[model samples]
Target: MIVKPRLPVINRAHPLAKGLVADYPFFERGGTTLRDISGNNNHGTLTSMDPAVKWILTSQGYGLDFDTTDYVTIPDSDILDFGTSPFFVETWIKTTVNNVRQVAVAKADVTGNFIFEMGTYRTLTANEIYCEFYVSGLYPKVLVVDSSFFDGKVHHLVAGHDGTAVRLFIDGVLRGSNVSAYGNIDTASWAIGTYGAYSPPFRGWNGQIAKTRVWKKAPIAREIATLYADPWALYRSRRGIIGKAVAAAGVTYPQLERSFQRGAFRGIKMGVAA
Candidate 1:
């Protein structure tokens, strides 16, 4: 049987719920509105969704697919504006398109020259990963990692800036970092999948995304590692099964139960469920 555990809902028990600015599990569909469970009411609007807001069923419930032409737009709020204090953008992405500059998440002004961005470092084979944020009185630091995450499998990524420096983490491991000062960057609305004023030839992400989140405080490395190692420890969830030993035509509940209890069953367990 292929056991698909029910996705979770986080409350105070969630390790990083403290400064969560927004959380998008992308599990259950909510029309054009991508619900944000952070209780900050920063839900995003699906703009130009190619499949009219497509959500593909996964073991985690649902994952949104983004074509190069669509993106999510979240309104501006003070909580989202880090102002060079401390902040991070994190997400799970799976893709095979490393030949182009793909934007994962970014916040920019109307003219497309402001604040921060976390996206592909550049284009082509083994396209690097990167994060950039502007701090008043200083040029933005373009923190780029030497590797890529476009291997057609799901991977966790994080872009963060502590008060004094910037950091990048991939799959719970620190990929790279750079020393940087801080101050007020511009305050702007958020754009997912694509960035830069949502213009023509957008820096769109052509892939699947699940569980995107942001925190206004710097992430603790130990906490991040803990989340990567034991995601279930932070959230409560139920599990379900399907196929094979799963209940089938004419299979009585008792029979199915016996089968599930005895038959050699396999479960798809993703590493670092966070």
Candidate 2:
């Protein structure tokens, strides 16, 4: 007889559920300081002369909104440096700007040591993700995602070096791959929403960044698939009260039944705490 392990009935309000904090340097909070939710204490400091960057309430939680000119700066640390190790950066972003390159996450200097950019390549599709992986002595290897990310809806974006090649995942799908790899990506500092202090500061992201996660080890395809399905699952399982309210507010009950039919977590039962 085969027995299946019981999965915890996850509470959507609780982000620190089991196996959720596996990624290091995760930023999901929206506040003056972008605290690292991964419990690594690798928080990022907001840097902007004006109030261009601010926090906003998102469906998942609080998210950071950035103007085309605002960005966040993280101090130089060994944790941010991945030396020839498999690493990945994943985040949720929503944007409509596709005309110019928008840097969602980057680590490099003005001379272009290394950069993992989205909405890259001037005139390139706003939905594409770009990466410029380079070590001190090795030649730079640039890769772009096969898919686009300018859907105007919230979408998951991920880029990483999986020990042998560069990989890109858009909405849980392996959209791009490049065999050319690099050794040790070293940088003094890293920036979010823009390229590292480049002259004139190019590729500043103009969108809402909800969740940002950096992992030292590359996640397998199954893990990535789970991450993608989380939002849909949470909406169904955790919104019991809200879903009922919505149904009551509507004129038709059949619509609600249809919704439940299409919803996720069908058989899993959860009860409110008394």
Question: Which residue ranges in model 2 land beyond 4 Å of their true spot?
Answer: 1-31, 49-53, 123-127, 135-148, 231-274
* Ten residues in sequence with the least summed lDDT for candidate 1: 237-246
Q: Point to the candidate with the largest TM-score.
A: 1
| Candidate 2, residue 153: how far the Cα is off, in Å | 0.9
**TM-score of every candidate:** 0.76, 0.68
How high a TM-score does candidate 1 get? 0.76
Clash pairs detected, candidate 2 = 127-149
Q: Best candidate per lDDT, number? A: 1
Evaluated at residue 77, the lDDT of candidate 2 is 67
lDDT of 2 by residue, 1-274 (tens): 1111121233445432323332322222333466654445666777762333376544434467778677777666677677777877777777876566678887777675654554444434434456656644654444453334666666787777888887777788776777765566566567778887574256788887766767677656776776776532322334466446644685232343334345543653322211
What is the C-alpha lDDT profile of model 1 across 1-274, one tens digit per residue? 2232333456464556778878877744546778776678788888777434476644333567887787888888887877756888888777777556778888876776647777675534456777777665455555444444666777777888877677888788777787887656446788788784647227888888777888888877876676555333334322323322232354433343345345533354321132
